[model samples]
Target: MDNSVLRHDMVDGLEESLDRFPDAVSVAMRSVPRHEFVTDGPYQNRPTEHRKTNTTILAPTAVGRLLSALAVEPDHDVLVVGAGVGYTAAVIAEIVGDSNVHAVDITRTLVYEARENLQRAGYEGVLVDCRDGADGLPEYAPFDRILVEASAVKPPRRLLAQLADGGRLVMPMGVGEQTLVAIEDGDVAEKFGPLSFKPLLVDGEQTGSIVRNRTKREDPEYEGRGWHAGHGWEQDWIDWEAHH
Candidate 1:
């Protein structure tokens, strides 16, 4: 089958499933070639987990739900927390120009592969860097829209602070039972529904890194290999209150 046809069929499947799939996001998803990121079953709706990278490439329905929650506008500065396979960024690039899209990943290998994949997908203008996802790309702070591909107990302070005035951010909120949440003005505006995703991780917690035995960061005693995050204890802390 033609890739374009496959893409359309994928979008059609999402539209039928979702209660209110945004037309813009549906169009963008259909426009981006997911095959550029995944070698197998690019149009499939099931998530393929990569244990090596400790990341899951979200299914198309999940992608549709995220973008619909993100509600990005053209030329909006958007930051994706987990670059993963770069398919989500490419889809967002179609909605907001590629140059306006920025992404970061804790896994160095995933960053390199994401950049290459975005380039192959004709979304090279999207900036992808290898860094702690919890840090929220400070140099490109103040984004109009922020999308976190991973789940967290709470929205990281850095990411919330980086949001432009009146900007919106969407992420899966929780550990065992996560919900797709939309945040604005530093508060949870809405909760889409139950969403399960891998927990948000810092530099040291990522796959293939040394185990985190110490709770506090020992900056002076250790060489600059692990614990690359600016703030440590915050990412470690858990917010117990459920969404009000």
Candidate 2:
């Protein structure tokens, strides 16, 4: 398939999935070139499956759905973690304008590729950095919105502290079956539903403390059973034991 045709198909599929927020997200999706942010080898070899091949550009539907949940405004300052090849940042930059998008990735190669891709796509406003996604960019702290492209067992406190009051942190949380969590304010967090994502990694390591604490908190056999139940699904029931 031609790059243009593939781009159109992905955007169309994204539009369909993001029907809930048609006006806000679809316009952004249409404006960004999804192909530019993906690996050229994947783009050329498997044009149709390029996005998935490198796990760089997220599926259009997923990006659209997450963007809809973000409710980004034109003036909002957004921080993106696990920026991959910068496709999400580019799309978000289109929606909120480039000046408001700050993106970071842990891998040096990914960070370099993301910067090049964003530049090639004319999304110069996005600041790509090689850093720990869990720690976040403190120099540009107090963001109006933060989006984590990877999954975590719990919200990273370092990242949460960066959000402005009433700001939303959209991230996938859980062990096996991830749930999209939208945390508002630094104190209280809300779970949307079951979601799946590539686990967020820092220095090529999973969030050890966050996962352990969360597991114990959500364990049905734990002393805090009532509290765990009120928090929703029995997180301990997950197959974490199998791997451990």
TM-score of each: 0.87, 0.74
Clashing pairs in 2: 178-195
Worst 10 residues of 1 by lDDT: 230-239
Give candidate 2 misplaced runs (Cα > 4 Å): 1-6, 39-56, 187-191, 204-244
Candidate 2 C-alpha error for residue 65, in Å: 1.5
* Most TM-score-accurate candidate: 1
Model 1 stretches astray by more than 4 angstroms: 213-244
Residue-level lDDT tens digits of model 2 in 48-142: 22333234456556676677777788889999998887888988898788989999876676777789989999998789998878889999988
Error of 1 at 228 (Å): 24
Question: In candidate 1, residue 30 scores what lDDT?
Answer: 80
Q: After superposition, how far is residue 89 of candidate 2 from its true place, in Å?
A: 0.1
Please list the C-alpha lDDT of all candidates, in the order they appear. 0.84, 0.71
